[model samples]
Each structure stands twice: as structure tokens, then as C-alpha cells.
Target chain A: MIFKIAWRNIGRNKRRTLLTAASIFFAVFFSCVMTSINRGVFDKMIDDSVTSNVGYIQIHKKGFWDDQVINNAMVYDQQWKQELAAIDKVQTVIPRLQSAAMISFGKITKNVLVTGIDPAAENKLTNISNRVVDGEYLNADDQAVLIGEGLAKKLKATIGDTLILLSQGYRGVNAAQVYPIKGIVSFGVPALSSGMVYMPLAAAQYFYGANNLTTAVVLDVAGKEDVEEVLPPLYAKLDTNNTYEVMAWQEMIPDILNLKQTKDSSNKVVTIILYFIVGFGIFGTILMMTRERQYEFGVLLSIGMKRGQLAASVWIETLLLGLLGAVVGIALAYGLAYYLMVNPIVMQGEMAEAYTKFGMDPVMPASVALDIFWEQALTVLTITTLIALYPAFVIFRLQPVTAMRS
Target chain B: MNIVTVQQAQKTYNPDKIPVHALQGVDLTIEQGEFTALVGPSGSGKTTLLNAIGGLDLLTAGKIIINNQDIATFSDSELIEFRKQNIGFVFQAYNLIPVFTAKENVEFVMLLQGKSEQERDTRVRELLTAVGLADQIDRRPSELSGGQQQRVAVARALASKPQFILADEPTANLDSKSTADLLDIMLELNQKENITFLFSTHDQRVIDRARRVVTLEDGKIISDERVS
Candidate 1:
């Protein structure tokens, strides 16, 4: 009966209840959307950073990551690739022979990071085929190369044009090769586009004076959550006596990891301000709820309702309102987030340029993860419950006769 | 037997600044099954004495004994429990829960007492019938007239089977016809159920109908008279 009264009392002044509930609704809705957007952006950054250049996990010869030279390349065959691919959670293994070389096309010589890869394996790992803007992608036997669009513009070269590559191979052996540009492609990161080239693994290995050797074998995993679970097993399966290093994308890019952390801390400050504003709104409504009904409370108390029972009824009223608002907010937010996830907002203007300069995609998406809804809704509900203490206190301290006269 | 005993009852509001002594060293006893009226002008301490007897307010320097227990010895919470079990209250405004139907208002105290649903329903119907509101069982307070609402209040007060009912100006807001109807129901319950009723009011109709009248002026008892 007390609960019934409380439930009806919430609707006694429809406008007041709606005004109070609207604050809670916006608090949950905006909080969920903001957190989802933040997570989506960071998740995208990690995905682009991993798949665009660095695969999820990279395996290297000891000291190879510190100093990249043809001599430090690991000598492995097709059998090793088969073995690594058979491991659990390893999507595919990509072998690369990486070096820095000077390329010249009609006196426009430039230093670039040269990567030699098996086109099929590279396609499975990075989707290099989808990035091609002009001409065909590399075949396993082609003595052709894929050059960045920015690098192509710099060299004044087009597809099918031959470029001279010069570098010192393994053991300081002088290496020189002339290769036709197979395709031109763009990169989200401008730095990669400015000076990067790709060629067939066998051709680059033969030119560099290294046979059956590669600098790194990269492994692709599902997502950020899978990285830690997948790494320990891969390390355990490797030859313990041999010198090898396994690094996740996070370890390889400390600057990006630091950027995410900075963004998270700043997001916390904004969330705190929002919570502070919402707390006062809830407190004011509850204060009015108790203050305006002092006479009613006294009448109830004088007629034999216990203070504790009255207090509990009032608390339940606020709790019901909070839960209602949170559920509605979550429902509305879920719809918006699902839509945003499917159709991400493409950034434009200077923001797009800034994202490119920082080696990140310029799109903003919202995550529709279930945890986001639960977390945001519970936070608002807790705030509403906490603010209900004011009414409980007022009931506890009520002087029945005095309040009745008031 | 006297169900309530008041000795040297006194009540002071705000002792530190501008103290208004509402009750001053008075003595009164209310017997079971008696219909009594405490009549006085505003600030004459009739309501204060009633509040002290009902355990709604504490006396500055006195003892109110209900059922042989000195109510001053009880804590605030204990006093609330005591009122629930031993005293019922009816306010001038007919303070029925706005959301509850007439039947629910009558059943509320029994629910507080943790009575079984069957017991509460049975008692609610009986009390509302006695107050001539049986047909208006499902009507909320807003649906009922002032007289009907006051009659519901009476039924609610009697629902808990309290030792006595304290009505503070219960008919003050009612018209002459409604006030007469309310007094008739209350008088019938007093005579038929042998229940006690103590009311504080300035209404001459209530005073005329009461079996005992206690009048006060300036926080002191000016006269005590009995009729019929």
C-alpha cells in the first residue's frame, strides 16, 4: 500500500517528475554516447595503426627491432610459416625483408623504407590489394614494385615506369636493382605515403644478397582483447634457446598509447563536470519533493505511519523515477549508437588533415557495446539513489505537529 | 477505567528565543468509552494538551500515562509505535492519502500493523459500512465530498482498533449538514462499539453533542461540564 502510494505520488505532479527525469535521461544518454564515441575513436586508431602498417603482433630476431639491417634478418622457410599459421588465434603470418634504400627516377633521388613481401600473404594480413589506386598489384614472381602515391609524385613517376634502387645488402655488399612500378597507392598516414615502397620478397632478398631470410614475421589477431591472450601461447611455442622478440602494436607505438591515455584522462574531467551538474539537478528536485509535502508527511506520521516506513517509501519513489529515466535513456542511446557504428561520421576540413598527419583515420564512430549501456545507466541510477537521502533525512527529523501546522 | 492520564502537562515552543508556553501545568483524565471535547480559542493549549496525550509532542515538564506506561519514558520511535497501536488521529483537513480509495485509506493502518489481507479487507468493509460510506469504497478522497472524506477518516481511525481516537478540529472544514452527519456517526461508534473519542475543537455543535466538555482559556482549564 505504501509502495502504491509512492508510485502514484511520483505522478502527482507530472510536470515536476518529467523535469526531474529529463535531467537524468540526458545524463545517461549523453554519457553513454560520449563514452561510446571515445572508445570507438581509440579502437579505430589501434585498428588502423595495426592493420595499416604494423600487424597485431610482430616476431623479430633478437636486436633486429632495435637496429634494422639485412644481416639481422631471420632465415626461415615455408615450413616455418606453416607452423606459425597452425597456432591457435593466428590468422596468418606475413614475412617481410625490410630495409632503407635510395630510389632515383630521372635525378629525383629519395630515401625510402623498402619492404619486400609475398603478395598473397601480405594481402591476407593488410589488404594491400584494396589500397591499390592504379595498375595491378604485385604477383609472387613480378620484379615490379608498389610505391606510395606521395612517393610517386615526388619521383615524377607513373605506373609501368622503371626506378633505380640502390642500397648496401647483407655483409655490406653493394646492391642495385631496376624495377617497374606495379601500382600506386595512398596511405592514411602521410609519413608512410611520403617515403615507402613494396616489392616481391624473393626479388628484394636476392637483390639484398640475403637468401631465405626475412626481417620479421607479423601475426594478425582479432582485437585488443585477444592480444594478451594470444601472445603467451605464441611465445611458449617458439624455440626458447633461440633469440626472438614478440611485440604487440601497443609496445611498438608508445606515442599512440600515450595519446589514448591522455584522451581518457581528459574525458574523465568532462564526465565529472557533467555528473556534478546532474547531481545538483537531482538534489533540487528531491528537496522540493520533500519540502512541498511537509504537511502531508506530518499528517501521515501523526496518523501512525512510522518514520522509517515513510522514509523508505520516499526513497523508492526516487529510485523508480531514476530507473525509468535510465532505461529510456539507454533505449534511445542504443538506437543512436547502432546507427553511428554502421555509418561512421567522416571528418572533414583541417581535422582530416590533422588525423592524417598523426597517422590515424579521420572517421568518428560510436561503439554499441552492451557494457557501455550498463555502465552509464548504473552511474545515473546510483546518483539518483544517493540524492534521495535528502528526503529520507527530512522524514526522519519530522516533528508531526509542527509540520502539520506548516 | 481511565485510558489516558495527564498530570501537570506543559509544552513550550522554542525555549531559547520567544518561548510560547502552549500548555501549563494541567491535569486531565480520559476514561474508556467516553465522548469528550476539548474546547478553546486559538493558542489556548487545547490542541497542545491533545498532542501531548497522543504522544505527537512532548511536554516540557509533565507526564502523560497511556495504558499505565509513562509516555515520556519512551523514545521517539517507540512513541510512534505507541501511537500506531494505541492512538488514532483525525485532522481538520481530513488528511486522507490523496492516492488511496476510501477502502484503502481505512485499510492502511491495519496494513501497517501487518494484518493479513483477509483481516484488513473484512475490517475495512465493516468500518466504512459503519460510517455510511460502504458504497463509496472505491472512490478516492478527491471523489468524495468533505463530509464523506471526514467519515472515511473516522473509519480509518477505527480500523486499527485503537484505545482512543484524537480528532483535532475534525469538523472545522465541514458545512453544518456535514458536521451533523459526522458527529452522528462518531456518536454511534462511541455508543455501539464502546470506543473512546477525545477531540479538540472550537465548534459549538461538537461541544453540544459531547458527553463531557472541557474548556480552556490562556493555557489553563476555565471550566469542565458534563451534558446528559
Candidate 2:
């Protein structure tokens, strides 16, 4: 019966209730959108960072990550490869034999990071085969090289042209190789595009005199979120002697992780400001609601209704309004978020230039995670509950006789 | 048995600033089954005395004893419980909950008392019938006439089976016929159920029906007389 009264009382003044509820509704909607956008941007950053550079997880020699030299390369054991492939959520692993070298075709010579890769496994990890812009991608048995577009331009070399690579190999062995470029690939990152070379794993290893050795094993998982769950078990399955270190993408790029945290903290400030404005709106409406019903409250009190009970009923009324607003707001926010996710807003002008220059896509999308919706809705509802204390206080200190006379 | 005793009651509004004394050393007693009226001109302390006896307002000095218990000693929550179990009130404006039907308005007090639905239903029906609102039970206050709303208020006041009913200018907004009809219901309840009735009114019709009339002037009782 008290619930009935509280609900019906909400309808007694439709405009007042709607104004209050609308404030809460907008709070939920804006909060959800803000949180969704933040999550989407962060997700995109992580995805680009993982797929373009770090893969989801990486296994490196204990000291190799600190210094990337040919001497620190470990043997690429076929047994370890087959065992890791059998683990669940392990999509594929690509072993990279990387070394710095100076390449020359004719008169121009530039320093480059030459990567030795198994074509099929590298394709699965970085999709490098599809990124080939000119000529064909290299095969496992091919002695040909894949040169980056920027590197090829610097060397004035085209497909089928031979480029001379000169560098010191493992244990300071003088190493040199001349390889015909089979493919030219453009990378999203300018730095990578300008100073990269790819060759068949056996050919590069034989040339560098570091046969069957790889610097890192990059592991691509089924999904980005599964990295943490798959890491400990995968680590246990490999290197019980602790000769290798498994690093997640975030650990590999602590600078990007720090930047994301800074953005998240700023987003929280925005959410708090939005709630602060909406709280005042709700407070004003509830103040008017209580003041307007002073006579009715007095009547109820004088007729044996306890002030505490009356105050409780008023709180229930505010809760009902908050629930209505939150549910509707979440529904509306979900619709907008879903639409944005499907047709992301394309960036233009300066923003597009800035994003593309940094090797990231220029579009802005919204995430449709249920956690974002629920968390935002609960926050707004808590604000509504806090605003309700104003009316509750008014009812608490009410003097029935004075109220009735007024 | 005396249902209410107001001993040397004194009431002043805004005592800290400029005190306006509404009641001064006023003494009154009301027994069960008595249909009494506290009559006075405007601001003559009749309503203040009624409010004091009903435990709705605290007296500046002196004590109000209801059913041999001093209400001044009770805490605010205790007074609320006491009122819920003992006293009922009919306000001047017929302050029925606007959202409730006549039946719901009457049953609400009993609901607060934690009466069972079956008990509340039977009593609500009986009281609304006694107040001649049997046909208007389903109608909300807005849908009913002023007289009908007042009748529902009276039924609501009697729903908890209170020791007495305090009415302050209950007939002020009613028509002549509505006033007479309201008086008839109160008189019937007084005669048949021995329920005490106390009212503060300026209306002569309410004064005429009362068996005992207490007149107040200048915050003091000037006369207390009994009529045959």
C-alpha cells in the first residue's frame, strides 16, 4: 500500500517528476556515451599496437629484450613450436630472426633492421603477405628478400633487383649477403616502412651464420582479452628453467599503457562534472516536490502516519523515478552505441592527419559493452538516491500542526 | 472515563523573537461519549487547545494527558505511536489523500495500524456506510463532491477506532446541507459507540449540536456550559 501511494504520488505532478527524471536520464545517457567512447578509443589503440608491432604475447630470451643483437638469438626448437601450437587460444607463433645491417643497391646505402621470417607463420601473425604492394611475397624455401617501400625507394631498387646486405653476425663473424627483392611492402608506421627488410628464414640465417636461431617468438592469441588468461599456463608449458620471459603487449609498450591510463583518469573527471550538474537539477525538483506537499504530509502525520514512514515513502518515489530514467536511458544509449559501432564516425581534416600520421585509423567508434551501460546507470542512480535525502530531511523535521496551518 | 485532560496549557508561537501567545493557562477535559465543541472567534486559542489535546502541538507550559498518560513525556516517535493507536483527526480542508478512492482513504489508517486485509475491509465498509458514503467508496476525492469528501474524511478518522476524534473547522468549506449531514454522522457515532468528539469551530451549527460548549476568548476559557 505504501508502494502504491508512492508510485501514484509520482504521477500526481507529472511535470515535476518528468523534469527530475529527464535530468537523470540525460546523466545516464551522457555518462554511458563518454565511457563507451573512452573504451572504444583505448581498444583501438591496443589493437593497433598489438597487430602492427607487438602481437598479443611475445617470448624473448631473458636478456635479448634488453639488447637486440644477433649474438643473443636462441635456437628455434621445432619441438617447442609444435607444443605451443597445441595450446588452446594459441592462434599461431611466428619466430623472427632480427639484426641491424647496412644495405646498398648501386650508390645509396641505408641502415635497416632485417627480419628473417617463415612466410606462412608470419602471414598468420602480421598478415604481411596481404600487405605486399608490388611483386609476390616470399616463400619458405625462396632465397629472395621482401624490402619495404621506403627502403626500396631509398636504394632506387625495384622487384627482381639485388640488394647487398653487410653486417656482423653472431660472435662477430663477418657476414654479407646479396638477395633479389621479391616483394615491396608499405607499413602503416613510417619509421618501420623506411628501415625494414624481410627475407626467408633459412637464407637470412645462413647468410648471418646464425643458423636455426630466432630472437623472439611472437604469439597471436584468438582475442586480445584472452592474453592474460593464456599467459601463465603457456609460460608453465614452456621454459620451466626460466630462460625465457613472456611479455604481454602492454608490458612491451609501457609508454602506451601509461598514456591510456592518463586518458582514463581525465575521462573520470568529465563523468564527475556531468553528474554534479545533474545532481543539482534533481535536487531542485525534489525540493519543490516536498515543499508543495507540506500540507499533505502534515495531514498524513496528524492522522497517525509516522514521519519516518512518510519519509521512506518519499524515498521510494525517488527510487522509482530513478529506475525509470536509468532503464530508458540505457536503452537509448545502447541504440546510439550500436549505431556508432556499426558506422563509426570518420575523422577528417587535422584529426585524420594526426591519427594516420601516427599509424592509426582515423575513425571513431563506440563500444557496446554491457559493463559500460550498467556501471554508468548505477552511478546515476546513486546520485538520484543522494538527491532524495533533501526531501527526506524536510519530512523529518516537519511539524504537522504548523504545516497544516500554513 | 476522561479521554483528554488539558491542564493549564499554554502555547506561544515564536517565543524567542516576538511571542504571540495562542493559549494561556487554559484547562479543559473531555470524557468518552461526549459531543463537545470548543468555540471562539479567530485566534481565541480554540484550535491551539484542540491541537494541544490531540498531541499535534506541544504546549509551552503544562501537560496534556490523554487516557491518563501525559503526552508531554512521550518522545516524538512515541507520540506518533500513541496517536496511531488512540487519536484521529478531521482537518478543516477535508485533507483526504487525493490519489486514493474513498475506500482507500478510509482503509489507509487501518493499514498503518497493521490490521489484516480482511479486518480492514470489513471495518472500512462499515465506517463508510455509517458516514453515508457506501456508494461513493470507489470514487477518488477529486471525483466526489465536497460533502462526500468530508464524509470520507470522517470515516477515515474513525477507521482506527480511536478514543476520540478531533475536528478543527471541519465544516468550514461545506454547504449548509453538508454541514448538517456531517453533524448527524458525528452525533450518531457519539450516541451509539460512545466515541468522544472534540471540535474547534466558529460555525453555529456545529456549536448547536454539541452537548457541552467551551468558549475561549483572549487565550483563556471564558465559559464552560452544558446544554440539556
Candidate 3:
């Protein structure tokens, strides 16, 4: 019967109840959609960085990444390849020997990271061939280099141009190699296009006069979360005086992690402020509800209705109102998120440049998450329950005698 | 057996200075199945004494025993339980929750006691019909006339089936015609159900119709008489 009474009580001032619910609905809806967009942007950035720039997990030679010396290269024996393949969750691992070298075309010269890789193994790890815009990709045993579009334009070089490369190899030995540019590719980042270069792993190894690999190995994992799981065991198996450090994408790119962390922290600050604002809106309605029924409460007390029962009825009704708003908000936000994901919003001009600069996709695609809905529901419930405290306390302390006089 | 007992009860207001004594150690006993009235002017403290007896207010000193339980010593929770079972009240203002219909207002008392819906609906209908509000059962408090609202209040008070019913100036805000109609219906129910009706009022009409009247003056009972 109290339930019926509460239901009817809520219906008494339909407009007020709806207003309170509207505030809660907007709060939940806005937060869900905004957070989805933010998370989507960050996820895209991570994927781009992991696939194109750095693999999710990288296997480097002991002390090579820290010291950057060619002598620190892990031995390129067949044993390392077979052992790495046997590791669980190992998607693909490409052996590489990277060095800072000067590439010169006629009068033009610029320093670049000359990455030495097996074209086949690199292709299996990443879609390197699809990025070729001007010239053909590497053939087996093809001693060629794929330079970026920006690098080609700067050097006044085109397909089939032979470029001169000079570098100091291990043990302070002077080394140089002449390579024909087989491709001028479209590297995503503007900086990378101007300063990046790739060549076959063995030809560069022969140029450096090293019988084996120099310094670095890159690895691609099955999933982002699997990075930690794969790294620890790989580290344990290859543990040698803690000389080698297995770095995940997150550690390799600290700036990107900082970017995501800063964005989420600001998002939380805005959400908390909105909660308090919506809380006051709901609280206002409840204040009117209790005040309007002051005389009624006294009468109820006089009639031997327990004050606690009255409080419970009011609390249950408010809870229903809050729950309704939360559910509706989540449902509406989900529909919006689905639509945005299908037809992603295209950002133009500075925003597009900003996204590319931060290594993010220019399009905003909303990610669907069940945890988001549950979180909004829980937040709404807690705020609504807290707002009911004042009314319940007032009801509990009411005196029937004074109320009747009033 | 006594249905309500007040033993040397005192109710005082304004604790700091110039305290106005409301109920000055008044002793009273109301027997089972009796219709009684505490009649007085505005400042006679009749309402104060009624409140002290009804467990709505605490006595400055002394005790009140209702239905064999010493309510003056009862805790807040115990008092609520005792009141839920033993007492029903109708206020001077038509104190029906504005949101609920006449039927819902009457059904609320039984709701607190956790009565089933069917039992509550049947009892509510019977009570409404008894108060001559049968046709207006579905109307909200604002939709009803002043007289009809009072009738709903009466039905609500009787819905819980309490041992004693306290009506503090139930017709104070009603027109004379509404007052006459309300008193007539209450008198009929009192006779038919053999339920005790205790009223604290200044209204001559309620005092005139009551079977027994206890007059109070300046915080003390000046006269206790069987008027009818």
C-alpha cells in the first residue's frame, strides 16, 4: 500500500518530477557520449602508433636501445627466431638493424634513421607494401630503399634514383653504402616522411660488416592488453643480467600516454561538477515534495502511520525516478554512439591537423561499451539516494501535534 | 477496562523564561466504547492535553498508559508500533494527501499496517460509504468539497481500526453546514461501531453533539459532565 501511495505521490506533481529526471537524463547522456568519443580518439591514436611507428611489444638487444651502439645487437642465429616463434601470443617479430645515417642525393643531404628489415618479415608484421604511392615494392634480394614522399621531394629524387648513405659502424669503423630508391612512399606523419628510410636487413648488415643483426628487433602482438602478458614471460625466458629491456608501446611513447591521461582526467572533473549540478536539481524537487506535504505527514503520524514507513515510501519513489532517467539516458546515448560509429564525424582544417600531429585518426568513431551504461546508472542512483536524505530526516522528526495546528 | 489513561501529565511550552503551562499534571481515564470531548476556548490547553495523551508529545513529567502499555516510557519506535495499532487521528485541516484520491487517502492507514490490497479496498469502500463519500471515492482532495474532504478524513481515521480515535477540532475549518453533517456522521458511526471518539475542540456544535464533555480552563479541567 505504501508502494501505491508512493507511486501516486510521484504523480501528484508530474511536472516537477519530470524536470528533476530531465536534469539527470542530460547528465548521463552527455557524459556517456563524450567519454565514448574521447576513448575512441585515444584508441585510434594507440593503434596508429603501435602498427606504423612502434609495435605493441619490441624485443631489443641487451642494452642497445639505452646505449644505441651496434655492438649491443643480439646474435642473429636461427635459434633466436625459433624460440621467439614458440612464445605464446607472439604475432610477428621482425629482426632489424637501425642506425642514424646521412643519405645524400647530388647536392642534397639529410640525416635519417636507416631501418634495416627483411621485406617479407616486415610485411607479415605490418602492411608496408600498401603504403607505396609512387614506385614498386621490394623484390626478393632487391637491394633498394623506400624513402618517404617528403624525403623524395626534398632530395629532388624519384623512383630508381641511387642515393648515397654514410654511417660509422660498430667498433668506430667508417662504413658507407649506395642504394637505389625503389619506392617513394606516403608515410603518415609529416616528420616521418621527411626523416625516415627503410632497406633490406641483410644488405645493410653486409654494409655494416656485421655477420649478424645490429641492436634492435620489433614485435607485433595479438592484442594491446596482451602486451603485458607476453612481455613478462618473454623477459623471464630471455633474462640475462637485466641487460635487455622489453618496452611496450605505452612506455615507448610516453607523450601519447600523457595525452590520454590528461584528457580522461579533465573528463572526470567535468563529470563530477555536472553530477553536483544535477544533484541540486533533483534535490530542489524533493524539497518541494516534502514541504508541500508537511500537513499530510503530521496527519499520517497522528493516524498511527510509522514515520519510517512514510520516509521509505518517498525514498522508493525517488529511486524509481532516478532509475528511469538513468536507463533512458543510457539507451539514448547508445543509439547516438552507434550512429556516430557507422557514420563517423569528419573533422576538418586545424582539427584534422591536430589529430594527425598527435598520431590520431581525423575521424571520430564512438566506441560502444556496456560498462559506460552501468557506470551512469550507478552514478544516478547514488546521487538520487543522497538527495532523499533531507526529506527522510524531516519526516522522521515530525510531531503530529504541531503539524495539526499548522 | 480503560482504553486511554493519563496520570498526572504535564505539558509546558517556552522552556527558557515565562513558560506557558499547557497540561498541568492532568489525570484522566477514558473507558472502552465511549464518545468523549474535551471542550474549551482557544487558550485553555485542551489540544495540548490531547497531544500528550496521543503519544505525539512527551510530558514534562508524569505518565500516560494507553491500551495497557505505558506509552510515556515507550521509545520512539515502540511508540510508533503502539500508535499504529492503538490510535487513529483526524485533524482540523482536511489532511488528505493532495496527490491521492479519496479512496487512496482512506486506504493509506491500512497500508502502514501492511494490509493486503483486497482487504484495504473493501474496507476503504465501506468506510467511504459510511461517511457518505461513496460517489467521490475516485476524486483527489482538491476536487472534493470542504464537507466531502472532511468525510474522507473520517474514513481515513477509521480505516486502521484503532482502539481509540483522536479528532483535534476536526470541523474547525469547515462551514457550519459541513460541521453539522460531519458531526452527524461521526455520531452515527460511534453508535454503530461502539468505537470511542475523543475530540479536543472549541466548536459548540461538536460539544453540543458529544455524549460526554470535559471542559478545561487555563490548563486545568474545570468540569467533566455527561451532556447527553
Candidate 4:
């Protein structure tokens, strides 16, 4: 009976109910949009910086990350790659032998990081073929190099041009190679696009006087979320006993993670302010509803309805309104977020230029993650529930004769 | 058998500042099955005395004993329970719940009493029929005429089958025909079920139909007359 009464009571003043619901609707919608955009930008940042090149999880010699010398390089073992691949969610294990060297073309000489890779495996990890702008992609038997677009531009070199590489190899042996440039590849990160050189594994190992050696084994997973699940097994399977170090993407990219955290903290402050406004809007409506129904409450009391029952009815009424608003808000937010996700907002003018200069994508997309919807809806409902306590308090303190007189 | 007894009932409004006495040392007793009227002008303590007897308001100083239970000894919650079981009320403005249909209003009290659905349905139909609103049971208060709404109020008041029904100016908003029709229904219910009624009103029509009339003046009862 109380539920029936509460359901009917919400229809008593349609305008008031709509106004209250509108406040909650907008609060949920705006909060969802804000959080979604924030998360979407950070997800893109991780995709560009970490996932595309270094993979989400990496395995290297124990001190290789701290000291990138050839001495710290581990022997490239197929058995280790097979063991890592057996772990769940390990999509691919890419091997790379990298060292810093100076490249000279014509009269210009610039320092570049030379990376030795298996062509097929490296393509799976970074999709290098799709990023090639100038010439043919590298083949396992091809004694050629894929230079970054910025490096190619700086050296005034193109396809069919030979570039000289000079560096100290394993055990201080002089490592020098002259390889024809097969292609020019671009990267979203300015640093990589400006100074990266890719060569086949056999050629690079022979030139560096270190056969069957690799500096890092990059483990590609489906997404950043899979890193945690794949880490424990990888640790147990590999020789982590002071021989190798397993690093997740977050441990590799502290700067980007810190940036996301700072943005998230600000988003929380804004969300708090929005919910505060929503709370007051709902409280005002409840106050008016309670005052208008004071006489009716008195009659119900006089007719033997318990105060607790009456208060429960009023609270249920508020919850019904809140639920209605929240459901609608979620639906609307989902539609908008999904649309934005499919077709992101493209930056224009100065913003686009700035983003390109920084080697980042200029477009902004909203995250369509399901949790964002329910989390915002739950928060608004909680605010409405707390606001509803006002009516309960009034009903409990009401005097039948006095309220009826009013 | 006396259903209610009041001794030295005193109610002073705003006692701390310029107090106005609404009831002063009033004493009265009502018996079972009696159709009684408490008649007075405005501010003459008729409603105040009615409120006191109905346990809607606390007496400043007095003892109102109903069915041998001293009501002043009951807590606020106990008084609500006591009223639910023992007293019914009809107000001047026909205080039917606006959101409810006539049938729902009548069934509301029984629902509070936690009566079974079968019991509530049977009693609600019976009471609405008794009030001459049998055909208007499905209409909400806003849809019904003032007199019909008053009839619904009467049905609601009797839904709990209380010891007595207290009505304060029930006919104040009704026309002559509605007033007469309403009175006829009440008189029939009174004689047929032996149900007791106590009314506070200035309407001469209601006064003429009552078997006993008590008149108040300046917060005190001035006359008690029993008509044949």
C-alpha cells in the first residue's frame, strides 16, 4: 500500500517531478562525459607511447633497463620465447637487439638508435609495414634498413641510398655497417620518428659481433588491462632470480601515468561540485513537496498510518524519481559516448598543429566503457537518497493537529 | 454504558504568552450508541473539546478516559494506536486522501490495521454502500462532488469500526440537499448498527437530528439537553 501511494504521489505534481529529475539527469550525463573524455585521452596516450613500440610487458636482462650497454644483452633463445608465449594472453613475443650508433649520409651525420628485429614478429607488434611512407618493407633476407621519416629527411636520403652506421659492438669490437635504405617509417612519438633505425636481426648481430643476442623481449598483449594477468606466470616461468626483469607498461612510463593521475584528480573535484549542485536542486524540490503535503500527512497520521510508514512512502517516491532520471541519463550518455567513440572530435587550427608537433593524435574520443555509466548513475542516486532524509525527518517531527491546521 | 468520560478538560493556547483558553474545566460523558452534538459558535471550544476527546491534541489539564483507559497516560505513539482502534474522525473539509479513489480511501484505515484483503474488500464495499457512495467508489476525491467526498470521508472514518465517530462541521461545505442526504445516511447507520456519533457543529439541521445537544460558550459547556 505504501508503495502504491508513493508511486501515485509522484504523479501528483508532474512539473515539480520533471524539474527534479532534470537536475539529476544533467548531473549524471555531464559527469559521465567528463570522465569518459579524460579516460579516452589517456588510453590513446598509452596506445601511442607504449603499446605501439615497446609492448605492454617487457622482459630484459636484470640491469639492461638501467644500463643499455651491449654487455647487458641476453642471448636470443627460441625456447624462452616459446615459454613466454605459452602464458595466457601473451599475443606475441618480439625480440630486438638495439644499440646507439652514428649514421652518416652524404655530408650529414646524426646519432641514431639501431634496432635489430625479426621482420615478421616486429611487424606483428608495431604494424611497421603500414607506417612505411617511401619504399618497400624489410624482409628477413634483405640486407637493408628501415629509417624513421624524420631521420631520412635530416640525412637528405631516400630509398636506394646507402647509410653508414658506426658503433662499438660486443666486447668493444668496432661495429660498422653500410646498408641500403629499403623504406622510411613514421612514428607518433617525435623522438622515435627522428632517430630510429631498423635492420634485420642476422645482419645487425653479425655487424655488432654478437650472434644470437637480444637486448629485450617485448610481450604484446590484447590491452593494458591484460598485463597484470600475464605478469605472474611470466615471472614464474622465466628466470627472474636476478637474471631477468619483468616490467609492465606502467613501470616503464611513469611520466604518462602521473599525468593521467593529475587529470583524474581534477575531474573528481569538478564532479564533486556538480553533485553538490544536484543535491541542492533535489533538496529544494523535496522541501516544497513536503510542505505542500503537510495537510495530507496530518490526515494520514490521524487515520493511524505510522510515521515510519509515511516517511518510507515519501522516501520511496524520491527514489523512484531518482531511478527514472538515472536510467534516462545512462541511456542518453551511452548514445552520445558511443557516437563520439566512433567518430571522435577532430582538433582544428592551432590545436591540431600543436598536437602534430608533439607527435600525438589531435582528435578527442569519449570512452564507451560500461562502468562509467553505472558509476555515475549510482552516485546521483546516492545523492537523491541522502536528500530524501529531509522529508523523513519532517514527517517524524510533524504534529497532526498542527500540520492539519496549516 | 459510558464510552467516553472527560473531567476538567482544559486547553490553553500559547500558555507562556497571552494565553487564550480554548477549553476550560469542561466535564462530559457520552454513552454507547448515542447520537450527540456539540454545538457552539466559533472560538467557543467545540472543536477544541472534540480534538481533546479524539486524542488529536493533548489536554492542558484533564483526564479523558475512553473504555476505562486513561488516554493521558498513553505515549504519542500509543495515542495514535488508541485512536486507530477506538476513534474515528470526519473533518469539515472532507479530508479524503486526494490521490486515492473513494474505495481506496475507505480501505486505507483497514490496511493500516493489517486486515486481510478479503476482509478489507468486504468492509470497504459495505461502508461505501452505507454512505450512499456505492456507485462512486472508483472516483478520486477531486473527481467527486463535495458531498460525495464527504460521504467517502464518513466511509473512511467507519472503516476501522471504531467505538465512536467524531465529526467537526461535516456539513459546513455542503448544500441543503447534500446535507439532508448525508444526515439521513448517518441516522440510518446509527439506528441500524447502534454506532455512537459525536459531532461539533453550528448547523441547525445537524443539531435538530441529534438525540442529545450540548452547547458551549466562552470555553465552557452551558447546556446539555436530551430531546425525545
Candidate number of the best DockQ: 2
Lowest lDDT 10-mer window, candidate 2 chain A?
Answer: A235-244
Which candidate achieves the best lDDT against the true structure?
4
Clashing pairs in 4: none
Query: Alpha-carbon error at A31 in model 3, in Å?
Result: 3.3
Model 3 docking category: medium
lDDT of 4 by residue, B88-205 (tens): 9999999988888999999999999999999999999999888888898899999999999998998999999999999999999999999999999889989999899999999999
Write the residue-wise lDDT of candidate 3 on A289-397 in tens digits.
7887787788777676787788888888888778767788999999998898788899999999987765466899887767777888889888878987888999887
TM-score of chain B of each: 0.98, 0.98, 0.97, 0.99
| All candidates in order of TM-score, best leading | 4, 2, 3, 1
Clash number for every model? Answer: 0, 0, 1, 0
The global C-alpha lDDT for each of the candidates, from Candidate 1 onward, is 0.88, 0.88, 0.82, 0.90
Greater DockQ among 3 and 4 belongs to 4
What does DockQ give for each predicted structure?
Answer: 0.74, 0.79, 0.62, 0.75
TM-score of chain A of each: 0.89, 0.92, 0.91, 0.94
Model 3 spans with C-alpha error above 4 angstroms? A1-7, A76-79, A171-174, A211-214, A317-328, A357-359, A403-406
User: Residue-wise lDDT of candidate 2 within A58-147, one digit each (tens)?
Assistant: 887777888889898888889989877777888888888999999999999999999999898888877888879999999999988998
Report the error of model 3 at residue A129, Å: 2.1
